[model samples]
Target: MLNYRLFGDLSSSAAPLVVLHGLLGSLDNWHTFARGQAGKRTVLAIDLRNHGDSPHVAGMSYRQMVDDVVAVLDTLAIPECYLMGHSMGGKVAMMLALQHPSRVRRLLVVDIAPKAYPPRHQALLHAMVGMPLGELSSRKQADEWLSATVKHPFERGFLLKNLGRKTEGQFYWQCNLPEIARHYLKISGFPTTDAVYPAPTLFIRGGQSDYVADTDLPMIRQAFPAAELVTVAAAGHLPHVQTPAEFTVLVEAFLG
Candidate 1:
């Protein structure tokens, strides 16, 4: 099961919003977005399984991840919620809405499509697989090792969040690295389902991102008939990071 933390008081008469992070991303990434919308509604930002403070699992797939999300909602007794997610999380949001439409009041999917994506980060995956988890002395050592194979300080830093040390001084990764590496194909592919979500849905794509292209819109519409496409100009995969003001505006309007 995935470990989760609920933010804000649910008893305060605030509508609930559940936010999920991307692959290798923690709930901390949504801190700013969650905080920005806290006044409008209660926020629940979860560390998806195998990431953040969540427990490591044996394998990962859209269906399994969606079930984890549903489990969290069930624990809270939340029959429905406004949902938002990015990258891998976006795929999860899509699955949840499709497979559990009665549980999602509205869905916001950021920078991902329902279509199968090509394996673009196999090299990065290979490098992560090579990391000597048992030999790492500290997070700094892991960073140094990852620096040799992973470029982009921000990306390296994100990956370093997974590096952790146990009380016995044994080095390990906070996330299920082995499981994720083994399920690379499943992770990149969309699950097959006849379930179509009819609820209001928004596909917020970054203008410079190849993750969600015009070609994917057809597949998105076929799965989510109510989905509307909105592009955030001058942004890449992380639209919330590059275009916060615009992103928040769209989100607010959609959720309102």
Candidate 2:
């Protein structure tokens, strides 16, 4: 099972909310949001396989990722709960809802659609893999190295969160870069299914993100008959991080 951080009172009457983060992101991405939601209900933030503190396994597929989450729910004895996921994680949530509809009470997919995406993060992945972790004297140096490929400071900082120091000077990535790279194709592709999840579902897209396009709505509706899409103005791919306040409001309204 993937590593998870739980917040809130598990014994609360309200159903738990399971949060999954985007590609190259960990449970930490949802830490603040999960902590806020924990006041009313249980919030479980997960590190998908190959990311964060989770085991760096060989294969990467939607089925494998879904099973990892299911194992966590089974271990927690949670028969049903709400689920929210962003980007890559959103795809995982959608797959889980489709394959195991009864296990999901409500579903929220952020900034992604039920379709295949072209490999867009190759440069980022290459930068991550090529970074000489052993020689890095400080996080700043690592950031400098990443700056060559990852021009955006915010993105560089976000990716740097995965950098961990083993000793006084030596550093390594928390994610399994090699395996993720090997399975890039699988990660970019969505698994096909005739299955449908008819539960109330909300798809939140960033106003500036092309991840969820108008063309994808019909397919989304076909899979999730009750799904609705909302846009977060002036936000990009990571709307939860970019405009957390607005994002939280949308999530709370849907989950309520």
Best by lDDT: 2
Q: Compared with the true structure, what per-residue lDDT tens digits does model 1 show for residues 170-199? A: 877677777787887888888888889998
Task: Give Cα distance to truth, residue 243, candidate 2, Å.
Answer: 0.5
- Candidate 2 C-alpha lDDT tens digits along 1-256: 7899889756765679999998889999998888777556789899999999999998999999999999999998888989999999999999999999999999999999989888999988988898887788999999999999989999999999999998566898889989998999899999989999999999999999899988889989999999999999889999989998999999998887
Model 1: clashing residue pairs?
A: none
Clashing pairs in 2: none
Model 1, CA-based lDDT: 0.84
Model 2 CA lDDT for position 173: 88
Off by over 4 Å in 2: none
The candidate 2 region of ten consecutive residues with least summed lDDT is 6-15
